[model samples]
Target: MSLRRLLAPLCAGTLLLTTACSEGGEVAPAPRADPPAASDPGEGAAEILADMSLEEKVGQLFVPTLTGTTPEESAEVISAYHPGGFIYFPDNLQDTEQIVALSNGLQDRAVDDSGVPMFLGIDQEQGMVSRLPVGERFPDAMAVGATRDPDAATSLASVTAAELSALGINLDYAPVADVNINADNPVIGIRSFGSDPALVSELMTAEADAFEAGGVVPVAKHFPGHGDTDVDSHTGLPVIDKTRAEWEEVDLPPFVAAVESDIDMIMIAHVFMPELDDSGEPATLSPGIVTGILREELGYDGVVSTDALNMEGVRQTHDDGEIAVMAVLAGADQLLMPPDLATAHAAVVSAVEEGRITEERLDESVLRVLRLKLRRGLFDAAPVDPGEAAEVVGSAEHKDAAQQVADSSVTLLRNEGGVLPLREGASVRVVGSGSEEIGAELEGMGFTLAASAADADVAVVGTNGARGDAEQKGLVTQAQDAGVPVVVVAQGNPYDISELPGLDGYLATYSSVDVSRAAAARVIAGEVNPSGRLPVDIPGTDLAFGDGLTY
Candidate 1:
């Protein structure tokens, strides 16, 4: 079947004005309508948009950060700026009760001031990138990819969405769509699904669908792909040297699949692609990339949000206010995490008034955001119950589901001489960083702790980002030199295996979360059969994608 046929039904209720799919499996552009007057209450988002003042409309374009965990801490900004939403960070989240109170308090103030509920957004990607203080920690994207089960992706995201929604968080910046082809990528290593475009597309679409179905708006992120860069965008801007065709082959499939799946929002990356736009501007502020390619070519009319404006990647040449104006002119609907909310808000209002940004252009974005809020039932949402939230955030059922994903994703890369499935009562020495938790789990499974490599029958050494860690390599070598059978468990990036040449056994957990660690211990104890496959190829080695062994 063709891709269009498979995706047509998914685009039925898309909020874009021009990109909704027709009944005949073809995209039929809807005619743009003039802004409606605030005459009818039944007009939904249109009427709401018309009633908003210019300051209010500009305010709607930004999703800024709050000062503290309490709503009172942000009351000054809320009253003065009338922001459309607030994005939560680790400092802003405490416990379930505190989170519920904070979310409800913020929403109440927003509605009282602007007659619109705020979009409570968070970067709750689970696994390594989680922000919630209370919730089940599921495996990261690479681990989910290892299982080759799209259902696992859906279950993980669904559980995450339920927890976030219970705490009144409506927008989840998650289900990273980048296809990680570059093994040296620092920022997006395990966040990406895998190296294959088709695998990333399938898993990303499943996760996005599950998030929406579970009542949280999922923003498929770092678009045009952040998977091929070696530098972290938070520290500096990374340039992608790929031609447009090369980009289409590797970095474009998952995003294309996301748009077709009716993803409501996409976060633009901060990387600069000279081939896409040779203007020396990052994708966040590039009109050609954001407007020409993403909007015109890809036919994505949903909201386009900028990756946090406070990052150094987008702050190199422009001030916070100027960056805000440029992003709006570049066709972005939301400015996420601006460094100065007051400055960014005022600059946008000034631009619209000065004709640098037309009021119609501003309306287009405000209307899109409003339509999304209405479609997601944000305006009609009631305050989340603190008691219910406490019960639901970290429930036993959700944790079990997380453990299942971790169990299914523990990839056994090598089992030389069938060294795995260690015998019960074997004395093992566990060494290396993040191995303490693993050791505790191993001891619970009837394994005796050894004081040193020479005292142990086997050595299980943990390696995290081990490519450059000489200490980790020394630990493994120390064990091997003592003639102790070594089983190396990669707790972070699986590429660590390439650094250690000779090993009796190797296991890749692809994450260091508690659940994944426990799952690794279970695999070592022969309690669970290892079923995960390699999500990415290990450079300088014969270990390629889909490589794993079972006893």
Candidate 2:
């Protein structure tokens, strides 16, 4: 059968299925058709899942983090762990050539060993959490949220999906569904798509749809929400004080939307919620939250993944080897970046053998893993052309899309006395982490950088780092002292503006990445109209969510 013919029935069935699930609870099983043909990839996936041996099936549930870059270097670890997937970091990626070759070799080795393709996952969240050293970068999640434009969200994901897929990465741990309601949230501040539940849901769901259209599986992270907490899960477990009603009203909506939209994976956070689970265990190890609520109440039947298992949040409580078993028993399908690979894998295997973990439960997760890999086209095509990776990363089209998002995401919180949109040939003084990029961009836009702050028509100072609030305060104080009509450009957190008392202008890019910095400069130089509204509010200011100035 032709491809369209094969997809036609499945597509209708899928829509009907999701609609039914959304309207009510789970739908009844449909009538079975005749045995599927070999050409149907869905059936092929089922066949492969059924034929897998115990070892291969078990391996499909583990996705260990590899320390090596080369296939030869990683061979022993892959051979030993036989993970269904691997997550790569900056250490794993040297260049386009090296990483693509590494993926090709690993996939080739996996098929050779177990006749299964490995899923290569990357945390390409783009702004704060970028894995690859060089790719078309976007402004952070909050910045995209500032745009409040679903098109911008989709555009960024489309570029990201193309770049990652070309690099042989099948899964992207992105489109953070976490709404950053708490400004003091140490880890998930700008990483989330702003604080509003409805807005965050809209952007994140749009991002997931874009990723699916752009050829990658989008994993919505920190499920049941990580927005309201003030602690970092990587260090210590943050406890949420909200009741179940509050969770449903605030944090749970995005995850609910994602699952209802057929999102591929929902990542569990390591934060402890006393209301959800009184056991003191993080969601990663709590069957009450993961199985009872997320699986049963929430109606999310897709793969449930845990955040990095090596993080101190879950690591401090569970034995290194035992975390995997607990997470699986808690209803997690994939264990990500376990601290002790050999021990974790062995313990999970031992649990299965000892009837501590049921084989039926194990296979359910493994089969979902296999079906996801098949949907990613991994079974049909595992190895990507090396030349394709070289040609695609940060390509001109992607760069254009990145620039469009950044420009659209430029939110101006304060432009007291019309201090912005400086004259075309105005002299502007730029300073901060990305001063070079901002300076060059301003110069390119017919503005000249002044030799001194006193010489400039307007002093544009860029300040970042949430922890360096004091340093930014001093800069703002000094610039405010110079009295050169100081225009503060917030590169990372919009909250930085609050550190500066009185200012002539305040602009936020939400990041210091190249495209974002350029967008800030463009907005300052009057090259682009600043249309982005505040995704987050600057504390101690009149600015609130949905506040932005247009000139």
Candidate 3:
């Protein structure tokens, strides 16, 4: 069927596109019957693309970071670059009222300048990598993984979507699909769902679906797996030495699940896998991985976004210009957080003009981006209401949901002779990184607070990654030597338990958020049962995945 014929039904009921209809509504007396045809999804996007200039088309491929909290602060960049989207950082946000104004102002500017609305994005992952400060802080991804419930993942994404949408933010760079198999992984430690590929796949897909259902675009991140690496990609490059089979077994399953579930976007990682591409290029700049593996082998034709271009992992061998051009050549539809926006934008424009990057290639990405925007109703979305935003974000119901996840995720790794569920009204002394918060929670639960371990019946010591911190480990020793029952709580990383051995009781909260801390206090006080299991194996110990104790 012709494109015009297919689009007629879509325009039949709308007065906005009068051009799509005949000069008049005059109909033939005897019209021949035709078979019903399925509408072409790309027709509307293609029509929009046909009218765009080369610069505007190229601009649609870049989602850069804003300079400040308000739209006026970023006016120069917005007017010059015409970015398709803006990623929010901590500095770019203040409170709900300001955020709504910023989002609405930016969108108005984009619409006025180029007749296109911008994609307002944020990394509101709600755990360690959260960007928004006003929402109900939920536990980390690994904490949810410990609960072994996919519903928790869905709730997290759903609540996040609602809160973000209220604040006029539409895209969420979240639901990290990396199956964290390496215990030494610095960046993706607690951000990932779990170590098991199947578990990660299940939870990640659930979150992605929930985000989409709640009218927010979800971007599955660090593709080709940022897990299984010892280096932090933000400051340095991480090289993962794994055979293709090993990569498929460990890193590929979650991405495969994401692809199969039709995720809206996938953020490419900056890790170097020599086995995938021998050219020493990171996944963000390698056609062999981005185009060959993700597009060809995996059949993901949706929007493929590169990780932050400012990161050292992708910047070691190329300048901002080269990195931007190479990412397009490598099949990334979106260039996120480019180090230098002007240089990157000019480079992509020059590449297309010089035949280094074809206009056809550029259109493929622009079309994908436009299709997503159109599909998500970005073209017709109304300005967000600031009053509504205030009522929706960080609501009481949302806080309850967060607390439930935290409560279910408090994994009791060890409770020797039931040292936990301390005797009613037992005097406790809290110490360590989060001791102040933990102590406050215990006091609220009617436990008597003691100044020192020597004066307490139990020493509730909190450790946040005590593996390298001697002071934190010493607190545990002091509690043990004082002849008080030491109940160590691993508030950050679960591996802290291995460092502080011989504890009378041990708990792994997997995060240090207020909700997680409050849940830990409840677990100790026997108000809530410990049901969370190990999401990752404790290195250098017999403790494996799926290990946890209950009251």
**All models: lDDT?**
0.88, 0.82, 0.87
Best by lDDT: 1
Top TM-score hit? 3
Which 10-residue window in model 1 sums to the lowest lDDT?
A: 1-10
Alpha-carbon deviation at 465 in model 2, angstroms? 3.3
Write the residue-wise lDDT of candidate 1 on 324-436 in tens digits.
99999999999999998889998999999999999889988988898888778786577789999988999999999999999999999988888889987899899986679
Q: Mind sharing the TM-score for model 2?
A: 0.91
Kindly provide the TM-score of model 1 when superposed on the true structure, using C-alpha atoms: 0.92
Return the TM-score for each candidate structure.
Answer: 0.92, 0.91, 0.93
Residue-level lDDT of model 2, residues 174-283, one tens digit each, is 88999888878889888988988899999999999989887788999998788888889889989899888988888988988997898999899999999889998999
Clashing pairs in 3: none
The residue ranges of model 3 lying beyond 4 angstroms of the native Cα positions read: 1-40
